[model samples]
Target chain A: MRYALRGGKRLRGFLVLESAALHGISRAAALPAAAAVEALHAYSLVHDDLPCMDDDDLRRGQPTVHVRWDEATAVLAGDALQTLAFELCCDPVLGPAERRVALVAALAKASGAEGMVLGQALDIAAESAAAPLTLEEITALQAGKTGALIGFAAEAGAILAGADRLPLRAYAEAFGLAFQIADDILDVEGDPEAAGKRLGKDAGAGKATFVSLLGLERAKARAKDLVTMAELALAPYGAAAETLRDAARFAIARQS
Target chain B: MRYALRGGKRLRGFLVLESAALHGISRAAALPAAAAVEALHAYSLVHDDLPCMDDDDLRRGQPTVHVRWDEATAVLAGDALQTLAFELCCDPVLGPAERRVALVAALAKASGAEGMVLGQALDIAAESAAAPLTLEEITALQAGKTGALIGFAAEAGAILAGADRLPLRAYAEAFGLAFQIADDILDVEGDPEAAGKRLGKDAGAGKATFVSLLGLERAKARAKDLVTMAELALAPYGAAAETLRDAARFAIARQS
Candidate 1:
């Protein structure tokens, strides 16, 4: 957890909080859900840092959980974090069954195998990936692996905010794509210093990329389009959803 | 999944089906929920078999997931089954939001850390268990680890049947304790051949046991009392819960 916080993306937290506020849910009401989401994000990184997984030695310029502790300890700590996220869902501030269950359901999608694990699975599966992946297959794989969790985080705010399913599901899809495109672009163009680690390894590995598949110009357009779609989903909530809107644009546009 | 299906006492599934049937729910309407409960049961087994976790090699005369397919796949498969339980809850086949969400909540409790994973943590923690676990502490561990899921299954049935919470919870709890006690007895005195595996390891490990803490006869009596109590919880349901009553008696008396 210490290592996880070193390179904290306060932006993600801000997006979650802002959307909840827009929805008129109080700080106390949203804190648990927000904490759970962030914890989940951290836990993903912790596991992603593992030798068999992403194999990063450092995160946020600090030794990762696996490096600081050991592989076994890192594994257990990640397991503990997953458990803690669920426990926090009992955050008494959000007592309504409708909202709580909604948050829980979204979290499951963002963090579980179908979303994050499946994504990681694909990343590893592609280590020796021979065939060129089609646009559809790449989209599906990225959606399940990287995009799904971000989609969860974005849509989670709307759910907590009491937004209906149409907007919630819509923003979820858009933000998910936006998040993936941003990460992909970063890999292609980002300075290793700015990204806090390696860059272009994906291309070196011959792994598929938005740039590789769609070209840089087209990928940039796709990211912009997704950001616009994400913002429009929040239009239903008027200004309350603006923070989420801004975050989507910043997420895709920010160089780092 | 094949190995996960082999060794369960099925006490949890029994309580769920029994309680629901008593409340006038048809078997057809109850199928999905029952399968879900079973899947949860299967999932817990799969996780419990991991190397960094229980390090167990044998289950129901078969190698565990970690032993059979490697740790990563076991982890992923467990993750998939858990989300599958939630998706099952959303099945169009399941009726009445009250029952569906309630069932989902119960299912989550069984698999999540505080319940099963926490129990496993405590059990594994015992390898270097910092403190001497009292009989009560050990019981709590088993209750949370093993009993809670079983209880969830029973409660799932009652929720589907639309039974009141008081009866639902009561029936589930009694069955949980009864189910664990039966395992304790089986471990101590039952036949390995009938039980489908070895039975003497817990004693060698010096793991907590009812026979060690409460004596064999006292534990046997306690198991019987728990069965009686489980049946009493369903007095309101009468004949509808009769199968549950039979299962409880079977649990304590089973040779395996």
Candidate 2:
């Protein structure tokens, strides 16, 4: 579990903390929420790298959990990590019980059948599919696979404060899409050494992605536009959200 | 997920509903929790049946999720089912936000590294150990693997009503152990057709169990004693807990 959690941009965790800070919540109090998102993300990655799944052996430049230990250990670790995510959300330090419950509910919605899992199932189904996914299909897949959790993280702060989550939700929708697009772009052009894992596997597998559907230049342009929109969505918070604005840019700019 | 949930004893869900009734909470209000536990159990069974884990091809007299579908589908379905458990706990109909949060927290603790997952890891580790587990070690493993969730289910009603949970907790501890011991007994002597799934696999695999460690006769005696203890623990509830008492007796007496 610990190995699966190590070495990531922690963009989701960053969103949780930043969103919490915007709602006048202390970073310390919000730490559990940040940890929850990261743990959940790690669980997804561990399972994703399983032999029956993506079958990846490298993650963050290190041997994947299944490779480092064994498949059973990896499965148990990932399952435990996922349970830990919900446990963390219930931490009293996170806030009132109502808020904690809200977090748990939102997290379940985002990560379960309705969200990330659905996206993954779709991706897997597409692998053996008769035809490559269309642009719209790819977008829908990314929305569930990546957009959902990011949406939860960005909206968490507002939830903590019982404030409206629309602005942050809007910001996250664009930011998450931009992040995936950047990942697609990276797969096509970035160095595997810097990426820490194999690149171009999507194309190798004949999987359609933002890059495949939009082409290199067009995909890059779309990602930029989404980042801009993400930044614009933060207008409600003014200068206080500058770090978040930078995060939006960083989403598409990071190499790994 | 639905396929995975079919045809279980549903003892855990029964405990949740029965306990809730004891606390004056309507079964209707407690339905989500009952569903949550069954979902969680189904998820565990699905994952445990994977080739990398227990490698079972059959569950509930039908093909296991991975066997019927594929490993990827099984993985995603299990993952989603777990998430659904937490989501069910957060159902508004369950009661106040505080109660819902408590359920989520407790469920996470019971199902995560500190509980069932830890027990499973230990079981896997035991498989390759230099020697078989001792009687005490096996007891400890069962406590985590099987006892934790039963404890949560038995105590859930008390949690819902903000009542003292000691009596119900005590009852569940004894009941759960008795239930597992009976399962061991069944594996030794129960008809495979009646059991609905494969039996004798534990002894076949040379895994240490109550029957293996205590001898079949002694294990049967021990299970009966535990069932008595479980029934005795419900003395405080009087006739209102008759169904639960029946459940305890049934735990040891059931053919499957």
Chain A alone, TM-score per model: 0.91, 0.99
| Least accurate 10 contiguous residues by lDDT in model 1 chain B | B83-92
Q: Scored by CA lDDT, what does every candidate get? A: 0.70, 0.94
The TM-scores that each candidate's chain B achieves against the reference are 0.90, 0.98
Chain B TM-score, model 2, reads 0.98
**Tens digit per residue, CA lDDT, model 2, B40-76:** 9999999999999999998888999998999999999
Candidate 2 segments whose C-alpha is farther than 4 A from its true place: none
Candidate 2 CAPRI grade: high
List model 1 lDDT by residue over B156-187, tens digit each: 65577566667767766777787788888888
The DockQ values of the predictions, listed in order, are: 0.21, 0.94
Angstrom error at residue B116, model 1: 2.3
Return the TM-score for each candidate structure.
Answer: 0.79, 0.99
Winning model by TM-score? 2
